[model samples]
Target: MLHSEFYLFEEEKPLRCTVRNYQENDFQELIAIQSECFPPPFPDELWWNVEQLSSHLIHFPEGAICVEVNGELAGSLTCLRISYDPAHPHHTWEEITDNGYISTHDENGNALYVVDISIRPKFRKLGLGKLLMQNAYYVVIELGLDRLLGGGRMPGYKKYAENLSPEEYLKHALSGKLKDPVITFLLRCARTPVTILPHYLEDEESLNHAVLMEWKNPFK
Candidate 1:
């Protein structure tokens, strides 16, 4: 699909931004934005290197996207197609992504697996994350896929990790009682939690756990 045809919906303020596919020239800004979004140890295990980023563009050109606001890289969402089976177990981010290289991308797969979504710290809270997710949903529909899947890190859950399990924290977040800045927004967006993936990442923020979430395409 064309970049102009990807994000069909507009935000309230209509961020004067251009959402498009990743280009080779975007490498430096992309890495800068990623580093700003996740600093220190957080990015140590998550940020993609030059080769990995290049591989994404080469392997899944259409699935990797970025949002440019005022000539600056605001945010990006990287994903790839995968054939999934609900009867079988879901794979961890490392397993599915080949440790972030996206070597496992399957063009003929029926599900869109989100590898990463990063927004510059200054650009966050401006509905960019939701915008990125909406674009992913559009990709799913465009590809005639069944659903979108990914491991959602609960950055806020680390505060309660000593008391609540990831599952319990998810219940509270989904119950509309206690709100998690990330998971709550995702749940509100119609993404359902399937299971808790332990040791999903080395990031200390999520206590190394992540919620496996899925957004089934209602149009399918």
Candidate 2:
């Protein structure tokens, strides 16, 4: 299912790779990685929805990107456009209020929500995660978006071993599925909106925030 993508950024190898303005053409590639990384895997349709939303409402640099390693697609990130709206009072949302994810939203423009990013099995320890993130930081500049936000599940279970490398720890963590805390901490420290909500999965936090974010950052 892996095809050699003739990407414009293929020539650049500064330890980090970027996939700008992702579209339907990138759908299969994205799902390949998403299915590999996420458990219970989100429906394939979600990818289509994201692409539709981005194509319809996403603004400059507020789309998505993928990272390459050794000339192969290693990981991908989707930075979504989001914002706060007066119509929605997230003062009692679950993600912002509960489960402790950031709730802040950008008013003037939109925020970039780091939806998903995963490195292939062979690409760990290459400092790609941090590099991918640093690249996301530059996304704000590219999209002219003031702020970025997203929820990540942290590794609730981790066993650090002297013999194990950092990537080994990360791989263990990823296999254990601990990313929420990572996103929570980053959102808490970053300039994002704060809202209250119940368990993020069942609650309407993402929906509420999406409403606000979409309302402001709708298909441009």
Q: Largest lDDT belongs to which candidate?
A: 1
Write the residue-wise lDDT of candidate 1 on 1-220 in tens digits.
4365223224554445778998889898888887887887586647778898999988898888998776678889999999998876456888899888898999899899999989988777677888889899999998899999998888888888888888899888888768876677788667898888888888778888888889999898
| Weakest ten-residue segment in model 2 by summed lDDT | 208-217
Q: Top model by TM-score, which number?
A: 1
Q: What is the number of backbone collisions in each predicted candidate, taken in the order shown?
A: 0, 32
The positional error of residue 36 in candidate 2, measured at the CA in angstroms, is 1.3
lDDT of each: 0.83, 0.43
Q: Model 2, range 1-220, lDDT digits (tens) per residue?
A: 1122332333364443444445555556656765565434333433323443344223423445666654457776555445634455443323442221222223354556565556655555464565566566666665666455444432332233335443343454336544433433343233233332222332121221121111112223
Error in Å for residue 63 of model 2: 1.9
| Cα-lDDT of candidate 2 | 0.43
List the lowest-lDDT window of 10 residues for candidate 1.
1-10
